[model samples]
Target: MSQETVNYLVNLLIGVILAGVLSQYWRLEASGQSLRLWIIAAWTLAAADLFFVARSMLPPDTLPRLIPTITVTCGHALLLLAAQQTAQRPQQRRVICLIVASHLLLLLLLRAVPAMQGWRAPTNSVVWGSLSLAAALVLWRAADHVRPLMRFPAMVMAFQAFFHATRSLLATQAAVDANPVRSAAVQMLGDVEVSLFMVALFVGVLVAYLRQSNDDLRRALANVQQLSSMLPLCAWCNKVRDDDGYWRRIEEYLSEHKVSVTHSMCESCATKHFDEFKP
Candidate 1:
């Protein structure tokens, strides 16, 4: 209907796509079963968001009362999973599972009582703040345990949480007064918030993963390669020595490195050494 509404719809669809894509990516590259489960959890949250948008036949307050409860619940669940179980440490994973159960219990309580809607309003802020903090803590939580590349996804989550939290707070404020222009502005803002955060989080993690992969491939390649100039060898003795060690012949080391060689001898060496006939 309105430009704000259209933008909101567009952003919602785009965010869903991004979340699904990112989830799939995580599912594919994730090292552990728990990590893949978390990615699926994230996809679940994104699906809830889509459901919220689809069921918005009623007013915003009423629609949010259902879908957002599921969305926020799934979101926190997914984030906790990602934070603690990406690398699948059993102890941390247990803690994460506890946190998830606790958060969902809170959501269940809120759903049973409409008065808890106020509490739901602060959810985005709390979850985002928590996400940002959790990601930061991951820096120290298992810094010695996790790879730097593994940290990228958490950082992306942190940014996503902050954006969603701010958007939710602003949208709540906009909902209170029933101001037309402010409501429109809030809708526009939500679009921007959701779209950009999805892009940043998904694309950021993907790029980081690809870069890490490239670096690993390069390192693996470097291990077997030598960039140095060839060393002098004793032609008569058929010995080849590198900076590291002496080899019986050039063919020995070359075989390991996928190099092929053809045997050749000068006419003098061929006749003198092999035939033992000198002019």
Candidate 2:
């Protein structure tokens, strides 16, 4: 198959995989909403990839080039949002608005001015790199709260940012014109880098989810153990004082805590209460 055909098929497959993963996560009620944001990010990235695949199939200028650029920009923005959500950080509306507006302005410039077309690659690189770096920074700041495995995701984002920044520096028209072979090599390298980054991102998200689930399970077990421990009980009444300072009968307390108890009388209690019938 031709290179274009291969690229289209690969991107299509990636999109399908992302959609499947999103659907799987959607059905999981226990994953929580924040966790699902990662799946959303994946879907957005897949959409961007599909746009690229479509571009390969159609003739140049058949579709607005700006469409793919906007889609990719939105995908990167979603990645940053997902990272922020994962870190449990508050999303700053002002910052998000500014980023979106800047992207829109860039898109307008690209569409209106012929001269600005040459700068498109570098401009997109910078924007995408900045988003990736922001995600890395957010994840890094949340390192203390999350599991050690979270560092992998942060590192992956940082690597991606660095790669894009490097590309921006090397993607000049003069540089490409000077050495076509070198330019082609660099482009191929970027494709590989992006593929690797996607795999790392997916794996990191899965690891994060598993770690979160494990932590939740641990907390639940600790709560159960605490309830099973010694309680402050009245010596005569056999009533327990709970965390709220309310005294309740043992049966009532256990029932409230969702513990099942079988009612039974001890031998001494039975004999003392029924002396006439005692053996």
Candidate 3:
């Protein structure tokens, strides 16, 4: 098969794998809101890649080109949302909406103005690059404890930003149509890069999620340790049962567990012990 066909197959495979894995995790409730966005983004990305695979078969029309571009851009936006949520950052929904609207407007303008058609590829590249940069910045500025875990994904985003910016420079209308060899090489390189980015992103997000789970587990253990009221105690003997089912005096149990014990008498106990005890 031709190199282009091979690249298309590879992209299709990557997209399907990512979408399937993310969906499975989503069903499992592996995370929360952030993960839900991630799953959606993964599916969006898969759709974009599918379009890329089918573009060669489809007629050379604006709709075919426009569809994948919009799909991928939307996918990037979803990824950005996921990153913002993961970082516990304020999601500027209005700002994101405005940005997406502006991008769509630009695309619409290109479609309406024949003279501006040549600028479509560059415009899309700029938007994708900007979104990648935004995701990188969000990951970099996440909470200190999770920042280290996020750095790998941030770096991946940064690399993708550079790739998109470079692509924008190379994919001008004249350049694309004039030189078939150079364009093919660029396309091949891009497919490889995108696949790498997708896989790296999956790994990075999975690691971050695992870290979050570990943090949650640690917090839960701390809370469990602090909760002593749930312990089984015998009212008559005033003894507490240990985990091993051995009963011991309350003071002895608390002392054995390294808990400080204090002596206090409730009003009822005091009143029963001393007739002069007041409320």
Candidate 4:
């Protein structure tokens, strides 16, 4: 029932999911490289959660608390990167770096001024919310063939974006009023929401990957069928050309390709080859 216990469970679940995702990445072919970014993002979030659970034990200073904030911000950024890769969009690396740099600068400024400590939560929320929204939009607006595969993950991202935005507003109010109970309540809600979102988003992404892989397999099979139908045959010899550019009897080619054939002569061929039939 305690928030701390809840956070511990959530973190443990994230760790398990992260491990499973990494194993999946390993089992997949090279095409699953996009999952690398997601793994990193999940790791970043796990680090943040670890810091969050241990925040009470940390020294009473802005620097110590900023660790979680920084990690969480980076985690969102990496998620956006993963989304872009999934959608097969050109990654705006420079823009992403600039945004991160600006956020770090803002954090430094906040740290310099003790009076502005309250704004940290809102600032972090804004960055996270914006990044989540961007990722959702990217997936939603992807190419038609890719849109269906990404739709669920996009929806999850959109929901998280809205959650973070609303949380940001609550954080602003809490900062302004210095309300401990409201702040604690917001934190609890955020922990639960984030845990749910992570589980859903990753599951959605894994499903999307499966769909994409299946589509690719179907297309490959279709191509193979088309190619098989169009095999090159000699005009005079009736021999078929195999993949190695060697021509062989049609029967041989068919047999090599695992096709079963039965020997049968047409009436015309039978009559032409027999003198009695010709009469």
Candidate 5:
């Protein structure tokens, strides 16, 4: 297969796998709903990439190119939403809507004015880079609220922003007669870099989630242990005394604590209550 084909396959696989993993966690209590937005972003970008690979097969038109731009912009917007949610910040819905609308307007302008086609690449690069940088900033500012391991995803976002910006600058410098071999090599390298970055992002997010989940579990276990250790029970009634100094049945206390209690008489209790019926 051609290098471009290989790149397409690699990116497609990465996107699918990441989306699938996020979907699996979607239903889990510990995986928070924010991840679902991130999954949507991943899928959107993946679909855009797929379109990019198939661009040659599609009719050469403004719409074909515009579709990818729109999808990519939407994906980045979703990423911003995910980051905001992850940091427990108020989602600025108006700002997000404005961003999307502005991008769409710019895209429409580009489509209408053939003279401005040359500016499309740089403009898109700026938009993508800015969104990534914003996400990184959000992650950095919210560090205290998230696990320390979340720094990995933040760093990845920062690097991606830098790469996109640099690529845009480099594209502007390339001569019309640039060496085909060098251009091809650079393009291949960029694809590989992007694929690797996406993989890193997936792993980083997964690790952050797992670490947070583990910490939560540890805290919950500790609370349970502490509760078990200090529980006060009445010797005669077998009722438990809560912190409020109220005496409650053991089952009632457990139930109030969000623990499920099933009623069943123990073997000893059964034998004591009905000695002749003991099996």
Candidate 6:
């Protein structure tokens, strides 16, 4: 309820968002499709949270929970899509999209439920709990099929989601209709929840994306640098005839493939070409 606490949490969230962005740099050359999308979702959530925090600064009227409800819920869906992409199951991508769309409708209808407006106290904890559990299950499934490095990020996010679901259930059930202290605690938990969850997922996925990019880059560079070895020939004449019938200078052949060469006569070549000459 204190201004200092609110400012501190919001600032922390901002820091998390920046850390996530920095992590993306590492994926510069990777197949960053999924990673990029997830970071965008996180930054979007952070932006919305910032906006909510700003609105809360105005007055003590009923805190507008709608923006955050949409932001966080949609952000979670985006996170799931990203996780699925990283796991390389594009075939199941449409299923994930359908799930997201269904949730959007559910969340939209939540506005009619007066008690749901303030998540600090859940009038019906079971509904939210079940939904959160299902999302976690989906994330777990995605993790099951992902690569090792990506698996960690997915697991980290799943853990974050689990905690968030627990926090929601606890905060809601403890004070849905009763104590002020419990309500305040619920409010405090809600205040910090989005920030915490977004940071974990964002940081993990960004690091994974950047790493993927780096791997892709290294592979590409290796491909570019690869050359078929030429047959060993007399280094004296500078001719590099391969197993093939064609005879050509090694430097000339390499040049055709965008590889530059510097001319240098080796000791053997020097000795053979100028047998009687002094250095």
**Top-TM-score structure, candidate number:** 4
- Count of backbone collisions within predicted model 4: 0
Root-mean-square deviation (CA) per prediction: 9.5, 7.8, 7.6, 10.3, 7.2, 10.2
Prediction-by-prediction clash tally: 0, 0, 0, 0, 0, 4
lDDT of 1 by residue, 1-279 (tens): 656446557766776776677667655774533445545655665665566556665665553546555565556555555555544433355655666566667766766776555455455456545655675455336445355755666666666666667767765676565455765675566556656655665565556556666776686576455624555677787677766776667777565555677788998888788785545
lDDT tens per residue, model 4, 1-279: 556756856775685676467556646653444677877777778777877767756677747777777778888899899889878898988898888889988999988998987888788889989999999999998888889988999999999999989999999999999998888888788877877887888878777777777777887686568555787978998888888899888887666555577899898888788857553
TM-score of each: 0.58, 0.75, 0.73, 0.76, 0.75, 0.60
Which model is ahead, 2 or 5, in terms of lDDT? Answer: 5
What digit string (tens of lDDT, one per residue) describes model 3 on residues 1-279?
A: 566667767877887897788778667757453688887888788888888767767766556567777888889999899889878899977887788888988898888887666677678878989999999999999998768878888999999999889888887743547666766566677778878988889767777777777777787676558554587879898888877889888898777655578999998887788966544
Question: Ten-residue segment with the worst summed lDDT in candidate 5?
Answer: 171-180
Candidate 2 matches the true fold with a TM-score of 0.75
Question: Which pairs clash (backbone N, Cα, C closer than 3 Å) in model 4?
Answer: none
lDDT order, best first, reads: 4, 3, 5, 2, 1, 6
Among residues 3 or more apart in sequence or in different chains, the pairs in candidate 6 whose N, CA or C atoms overlap within 3 Å are 26-210, 27-210, 29-213, 30-213
**Full-model lDDT for every candidate:** 0.59, 0.74, 0.80, 0.81, 0.77, 0.57
**In candidate 2, which residue ranges exceed 4 Å CA deviation?**
147-149, 173-180, 229-279
lDDT of 2 by residue, 87-184 (tens): 87887657866886798787677757765555666677789899999989988887466736568888999999999998888767535466567566
Tens digit of per-residue lDDT, candidate 6, span 92-196? 556656765665566556556655545523522333344344444555565442465565555665566566567667766664555567767766766665555
Name the regions of candidate 5 deviating beyond 4 angstroms.
28-33, 175-189, 231-279
Best by lDDT: 4
Predicted structure 4: lDDT? 0.81
TM-score, prediction 4: 0.76
The deviation in Å at residue 70 for candidate 5 is 1.9
| Candidate 5 clashing pairs, residues 3+ apart or interchain | none
Error of 1 at 10 (Å): 2.3
